[model samples]
Target: MSSEPTHQNIHTFDQATALQPAGPHHWKGQPGRLYWNMVGPFGGTTAATLLHAVLLHPERIGEPAALTVNYAAPLADLPFVLEARPLRTNRSSQHWLLLMTQVDTEGQTITVASGTAVTALRRGTWAGSELPHPPVTPAENLSPRPPTAGLAWSERYDLRLLDGDLPTAWDGAHADDSLTRLWIQDLPPRPIDFLSLAAMSDMFYPRIWRRRALRTPAGTVSMTVYFHADQAALAAAGSGPLLGEARGQEYRHGFFDQRAQLWSADGTIMTTTHQLVYFRD
Candidate 1:
């Protein structure tokens, strides 16, 4: 055997999952890699960490059925506390409220973001769906997107754009084709879990960026997701480069609504998500 040592790259998803418990209701967060956005940590990762805080809570019950996160303020790249409190709990479901806060030199805690999640004990029953996964080119046939020059967070995912380009280069061939499809996976490929899946669900860039090729100031003000898959379904996907689609339905009054869906490689609808974004002309 050759005398060479081997190194394994860890997915950034796991790096963010390494939150340390600080107390009964709080955990510490650490920023990693190109996880930062134009102002702070990527919203997806921030949401994932918040959900993670709930998962680590001893009082948590069942799996996540729905989650809503509000980007109240920008997050600094310092140690922050994730406070997850169960709003209520019953035999079948539980609701939790989450907050991300930072302590200042004066020993005061500051709230940066807030979220709520619902976890429920799913039961076996007849399932039916009228929604179908959108047809797209198989991910294996498409090459990975070239990394965007300045966006560090973009490098964390292997995204294959099937429908639209960045607002920078709009061919204008299909102005009405606002639908954006991407085959995305962790940079190094990690198993699909609630945490990773939650982050992937928010991986779509702003819908306005694809609809109107303008460099307008836009951000997701609030996001919500409803999960349809359970732990077994997630495990069946293994380490997947999930197929995702997003599009804008309406835009007015400095805000727009976008809908997104994440499907497993086998065409299972894993999650359905929607977000309200704030935009300025």
Candidate 2:
């Protein structure tokens, strides 16, 4: 473990997702109330925490290339254990397996989440983006989303919606589609980094509620994120709000899938994500 002292001015996000080395390939973390959701801590923070472990690992290699997190169960508002193991290492890529476990009231250790990640040494090469950035009003001209009553995590982000705001009334109205485009950034304004990028990937609200206009029960079951931006690209983004777009592909048998992308102000695709979600009738 690095013996560096913690910065006194650490952001709440870093504090909430903070990890302390416990042993080889193991770390301890606790949920913060600031990122709490209805059932537990925000899924985005949880995902970021998992990635944080790998990022801090002494044996870690390269930057993050892809990450897949599976929410196995709700994590209680208590201390938890995170285990990140480098399963394999290659010249240009590394593979990792992650697990978050907590002790239940019954004294049994159970997994709350699991994940796999790939980090790779990127090489300079010719690259191109096929999808052009969508036309949307600048974030400066739009007002930030009001604080959501009960969901503390909503207050952590400055969201300026360009389309598909949450349903004003739960009248069971059905929209033609569930497409949301918005500009979002950390409320206190932090620099763009891989950890924050990972968290933002799961920031969108459940698509089912937006589609049916009903406050149905829904939560993400699994999420996968592909990192497209390199360190230079992220540095160019700075702390500016990213243009986020998301839409539901299908809803069937009490489940649905959401696809989302994050684009920098300069039109570089920072990350793309897809998630499977479960909803109740």
Candidate 3:
């Protein structure tokens, strides 16, 4: 038999975001070109990698409840160090601090990204969702979104746009609002998990691209994802497409904020994300 890796069915997302243990609280990883963006690896993969480090921690408790990632600088395509530490662990919750750093060409190690995460032992309680799922055509009825030509990261997910696509004109005319609704899932159909959910949270394209119709430079500075569903809920979601909705709240002074929510076909809100983005004028 030919000598190939045993796990041939491993999905590309998992391989791209994989990390290896280096020390008690450190891991080593390198960026993969499959998720490369205009500048560096996709921010979603970065966030997922950071969270995955915590999940792989031996002392980890419960499931992810919240995660906030701040991109400090454009990550270079190089081997990097990941440090994850549990700051506090109580009876019901745990807090963590994470940092990713890489050595620059000048031989100085600098931070590229940092984040804070919370995992908790979920307890049953009375709950209700005030924001009902948006009414839209089912995923089966819509055609798959055409692949974005140059961005490799966009190809990782199968997207079916329902509304609010990129502007047809580039004349700097601003739309009245920035809103996009789409169905999204891993292209090769990986099982739904916290790590995958974390990545999917940052899947939307910059809202400014659709709002102003201008191809201005834009990047996420900070992003936060709040998990509304526990492990069982996520498992139930399987590998099916999730309905994702994103809209911009405000844009001012070269910065804008976006809010997005992802829901299961059955109407369970899996996660909600908010992010602050930097853009060029």
Name the runs in model 1 displaced over 4 angstroms: 1-10, 104-108, 168-174
Give TM per candidate.
0.91, 0.96, 0.96
* Model 1 global lDDT (CA atoms, 0 to 1): 0.82
Q: How does each model score on lDDT? A: 0.82, 0.91, 0.89
Distance from true location, Cα of 187 in model 3, Å: 0.5
| Alpha-carbon shift of residue 51 in model 2 (angstroms) | 0.4
Query: Candidate 1 at 42: error in angstroms?
Result: 1.2
Per-residue lDDT tens digits for candidate 3, residues 145-263, read 77778988887788889998777788888888888999988887777888888888998889999888899999999999999988778888988688899999999999999999999
Query: What 10-residue stretch in candidate 1 is worst by lDDT?
Result: 1-10
Which candidate has the top score in lDDT?
2
lDDT of 1 by residue, 1-281 (tens): 11222234555666755699898888997766457778777888888888898888999899999999998877777788788999999999999999888865677788878889999999999988766777789888998888777677777778988887576665433366468888988876777888877888888887776777766788889989898989999998887878898888999999998899899988898889999999997
Q: List the RMSD of every prediction in angstroms.
A: 3.5, 3.8, 3.2
| lDDT winner, 2 or 3 | 2
lDDT of 2 at 76: 94
Q: Over the stretch 1-281, how does candidate 2's per-residue lDDT look in tens digits?
A: 12232348777689878999999999998886878899998898999999999999999888999999999999998889999999999998999999999999899999999999999999998998876899889888999989789988887888999999999999999998999999988877788899899999998999989989999899999999999988999999998699999999999998999999999988999999999999998
